[model samples]
Target: MKMRNLPPLNALKMFEAVARNSSFSLAAEELCITHSAVSHQIKLLESWMGVKLLQRHSHGATLTPAGQILFTTCVQLFNSLENCINDIQQKPINHGITLGAPSSFMANWLISRIESFEEKYPEIQIKLMTSNDFKLLENEQIDLQILSLNRQVQLKSDLVKIHLFKDKIGPVLSSEKAHNITQPSDLLTQTLLHTESNKNAWSFWATQHQVKLNEAKNQRYFDHLNLMLEAAANGLGIAIAPEILVEKQILNGQLIAPFGFTDSDAEFTLCLKQNCLKNSNLQTFIEWIQYQVSID
Candidate 1:
């Protein structure tokens, strides 16, 4: 058997940091090292590789073609190493699977239904992580991710995507404020709430309904959809949200969807690595979640 020759591990670590951040100074700060030390390590790496890895500019640095290739490999290697460490550290505990999803979905949809899964699979523990970063999947930080995507968009080849449910969105407001929004035009007279992540959701709905938002005078923006929905329930304004998320609020008489929901091109999807289903526990979760969505 032949041993593989590798670059200096420390130098590779510094190079990865610099490439990921696109700034030597920021990487140095994150690594708690001097800027000059970071530069030295990068130079050492470049000397060994005999290639110009980075193109420096006044603003920051950009990776060369070779650098990009190396960076990609390094990211995959590091994530695998981290996951291995985590699995070893948590082996004494119950078998755990980390699930990541958007904050709004986690709070409004999954949280209420997760207890059923936990009760059914007592030996398998679920760890909830809320993040909109899809890159986390590639980083191996989460075993599975729940994402909302337009049906037209395509994912990478190595990822496996499962259809969860159709996404239907509509304008929702407090019961007291619903009366004022009898028609689409009536929205112009009310303050429209928007989520920063999906700033164009209202526009998309308006276009589909043949309603114009150009004359809408008052509007507010929230960082999260859950916060925007809470504002609507509190009578702050009318917010456009997915029906699945606002079902409980509407059922509780806190919100009213006078216009009713319209089917959108987007749908909730479950994304995981191609090989993830090999794990029985994870496979069980996939089956259970698919069943849940099917019944819903």
Candidate 2:
């Protein structure tokens, strides 16, 4: 770091540009200086180092053994400096954030709100993967997850968990299909659509209403809430849906909630490996989610 022992940085930069391009004119063009200025800096660098770095030819220039060594070192040094600057500036140096969640939540909830998040943080690119498997985070395949968990579920203690909100369950049907039913028991005559992931949703709603459901009817089952809600909107049958995921559909008249919603023991939670909490991109996304919840 002693300034007296080092050659001038401007001279070193000029020499590097000349050596890289093998032409003083090209280096001067890149540095926005006259060709004579580039030649003068190169002479200054050689005088300071007491070694001839470039062997000038009639057509161009070539690096001597000493010059080649210096050029290689300069390339690495400049590249490292650029990387440090990028990290300090919070500029993107690699692929952006990656998140994982269940298929239903990804399709029904997060997909709808992602555009606003993108608009707010245009510099950060977000990739969403749908999988029920939590192992992806352990393998470093995903940075974080939006997990839906029942109260009885247990997770590793080291993982950071943030509770966004609890989910509520209710019957959702199309407007035309919902008009026939005046009471809860009237659902006995209609075919019911079921989501395999939330098999207990209807039972929770029925318990809240103090009504028994007729289970003998043939019920159609879907693996995710997105498909079940879509089926209900198409008048396939009345589906036991989560209020949080289907709120927009109900508001748009795509689906109707005949009976009011009831709280379920399940919660919608944000999960990430403890170390990922320090990542700025993930932090921004988590703060956005918190902001959304506050407004709701």
Candidate 3:
């Protein structure tokens, strides 16, 4: 096979960093290199490739059309390399388990309890991947998944599903703002916070309670539930969230669940390949997590 010439690896690395960040200065800061050095390397890369990759403006940089193609390839290449390295590293002892779940659940519930699990089973290492998409489990990228789904939905026959807890959702806001929101109708006068991943959360709650939600009400949306919760705690707006995710905030007096939680059709559930439990480390983690949920 004929070996194809490739761009310098270091320059490619810098290019990926700069393109990913959209700023040479930020890339330099991340890579521990000088701004001028990044510029020089990018220039060298452009010269070697005979095409401009970035357009520098006063604010930062933007990728050229060719740069976009290269960037996409670089991202996939780097990700595959990382997975290869991780697989190689874990092959010997194989005590590591990669668990995927929604960001809100991982941030608000799982992370705090992870320390206890680690203390009890020091030999087991848990790698958490935050994602709302359960389809990731089909790709075999992760060993287990924590999914939030409607109770009425049928489980996939090929996978093992365990009920972790019922998802109880309600409207929450800063305690100071709670007083003004005495009833569900008051929400119409205030800004309603929404999360992109759970777009129907407020609507679902409203439908369940037979509350007429005003479509034209003031509203704000966040990419993740955690961010929306933070905005709510900061008095930005009222947010609908699962009780488990906002329990700490409610207890700390930072937020209040004015409506209190009601059972949603949804529930948090654990999922894994049918045969995954055969792995001793994964089995131990599954047992520990189930016990944790039982006690909680």
Candidate 4:
């Protein structure tokens, strides 16, 4: 018989279990159905497929040649069905929100205050992913994304950008390591740390301040903003970083800004998918973040 002429899903399920165990009583116990129901389902499956699906012994059943083929196919079919049902029964995006952010924000800022956000919105299970810089609107795969940029992006209808906050950038090093650091030229004498995370960030700041760095001296490379901060804080080298991001460390004498700050190439913004932005959970989070984050 053709495989398409099989019995309903439930009967095929019974056939698979009975065929595998070769015991009607065990199949019944496993399926939580009576022995009669199991026997009836196997009969229906055999008849619908126009093939002998089971060999009747005095106390058990075995698969004939036709039955063996049908049983093998049904095993796969029922197993796939079971997996499909289980996947469907799982959460709606697991009742969670996935967000993307810069590593610096995660380490120095967002991570510090996430406990409050979680407590305020207990219904949501927030999941966070980080990157050195924001992804393109066309390629991003997140519910909500936090991006820091110096320029405004003119995107089409599918993308929406929200201004989050803006901060200046400058060269920061440990004040304890501030010895012999008298002037901007003295910055050349100290270890130079650069975060390659932001695109042309160091160059743009240098251009803004009329300072020319040799560029070859950028000995250290970091994939994320937090590592740059951590390295500078550990007295590994002097790093160019966001002013507000290192404010706490500066107050605690962990890091200090040796020279004045310059405007960043872009401000921190939240870029969201328009369709996902309409989700009530995400909208509430957006409003909460906008309110909590200082936009100035």
Candidate 5:
């Protein structure tokens, strides 16, 4: 994996930017160059290789079959170089730690508490990514990840997982709507709000409370948890949400949980690769997370 025979650095970077973003104009903006300059670089590369690498459409540039092959090779090249640099460094790879978290977790927990982590480790930069699917750790170059383990998750890697905290969830409603939900059976009388995006939520909560859901009675559904919370805040209906995400709202009296319903529910975990589990930089992150969980 010697870099001695590689193509020009500028060309490789331009190719990657366009490939990753799929637009010459976007690549130009990212590289601080003009769109025509990006096109010129691609043209030179195409002439050298004697192939049409990209299919330019009105919307964006898509990789031609040849471009797809080249892009795949470049991604490997970058990953290998990253691994090599990490292995060569004598210290705990501190400059950057790439992270992946659930969108629900990001919107609720991580974003709010991020300033503290940054203040403590200002020298160690972080790149945050979000996905509801926690399985991104299997193939991605993620240093750490967080996920809700309410259900059995399918993943493809051998990982060292640390359980962070269990989510205590119950129905949240506006003060006005709270009147209709006197008991579990009264849930049927109200305008049931839900997140159809999370397939297991409603059914699982129903099973936990020993109640059946008349799906037909559901009045509103949203894809994102934050949106559902907003709807409930506006007196839309009762929303079943984790206490961790809505703690600020609950504390401020914007919402209410009239019935306490956390009855031996499933949990979420904050996990990392075991080999680097004791890395000083990552250890700082782990300690901070554990402190929050402990106090809660």
Candidate 6:
């Protein structure tokens, strides 16, 4: 679309700001210019159209009939331009799959193995996005997700799920903290860190081991699994997390699972929109994830 015999684009933009704000001072602040600069643009725009567009009073300014019409048009035009720019920015630069998953899973498990996937499929770029909301997948904002299913997940008809691995739960703490723990009952004496989402982690582990915890002496609750693990590593308290997620920390002696690991009802799964299966990049990611889980 072309604007023939229209005022300069910058003048129109300044006019739109002033007209919408109803104050030259506010328009100048928003446009990062002096109030005189805003007044100059408005004068230039009025001269180009040969008609006054704004009514100025000692109190403030009000849009004239012509200004009201132009303001509405400018709003729609600017909004459309913004949407176009967003669409262009989101377009993938190379053949790739955007994988969305929980922040903790990305930090603990996927970050370590991402290089291996890259080596296997150098041409296929993998974009990792941190997300846990299913709405993002439904909206097609992300290509795939790796999530732990705490209960039976009901997916939309157009989505599919692939089993990854069962979550292994246990009490993990720093090496220093583990040294004092000789038996399962000893855990009750130390501070207990709980993941806010997985409130029953300690109770489940205790029940599996046939031990009971009388209300913990000190407790800290975290919203994210990574934070809970970090606190555990710093000797703040014992945290219950999937052993698979903390395997690297355990091997490096940063933390230890003194109570051992046990299988939980929760299982990790890769979920993707059905249409994504046709894209070879996403297909490669799905298979690579399965192989990684198998070896883990």
Comparing 3 and 4 on lDDT, the stronger one: 3
Q: Candidate 4 lDDT, tens digit per residue, 1-296?
A: 65664358788788877876678988999999899999988888777878777878987876554565455455444544544686798723455666777656654666546657788988886666654444633575457778776575675688788987775888888876788788666666667777666647666777776666673344577765556776888888888888767776788687888786777867888877787766988888888787778542
Per-residue lDDT over 84-149 for candidate 1, one digit per residue giving the tens place of the 0 to 100 score: 787888754445788888767765677557768988998887776665767988888788999889
lDDT of 2 by residue, 80-127 (tens): 565579899989766577777775665456655776898888898766
Residue 277 CA error for candidate 2 (Å)? 1.9
Strongest candidate by lDDT: 1
Error of 2 at 114 (Å): 1.5
Question: Which pairs of residues have clashing backbones in candidate 6?
Answer: none
lDDT of 1: 0.83
- How badly does each model clash, as a count of residue pairs? 0, 0, 0, 4, 0, 0
Q: In candidate 1, which residue pairs get closer than 3 Å at backbone N, Cα or C atoms, i.e. clash? A: none
Badly placed stretches (over 4 Å) of model 6 are 1-95
**Which wins on TM-score, candidate 4 or candidate 5?**
5
Ranking by lDDT, best first?
A: 1, 3, 6, 2, 5, 4
Candidate 1 residue runs with Cα over 4 Å from true position: 1-94
Tens-digit lDDT string for candidate 3 (75-103): 54675576688788885434578788875
Q: Write the per-residue lDDT of candidate 5 for residues 1-296, one digit (tens) a residue.
A: 76565556677779877876778988999999999999988888887778788879998787654575466456546655756787898545556776777656664666546657777778876656654454656555677888776536544455777777776778888888887677776776677677754556666677777877864366678866766886788887878888787886688677898876573345677667657776777887888888877877
Worst 10 residues of 5 by lDDT: 149-158
Q: Is candidate 2 or candidate 4 better by lDDT?
A: 2
* Candidate ranking (TM-score, best to worst): 3, 1, 6, 2, 5, 4
TM-score of each: 0.69, 0.65, 0.70, 0.63, 0.64, 0.67
lDDT of 4 at 142: 55
Candidate 2 colliding pairs: none
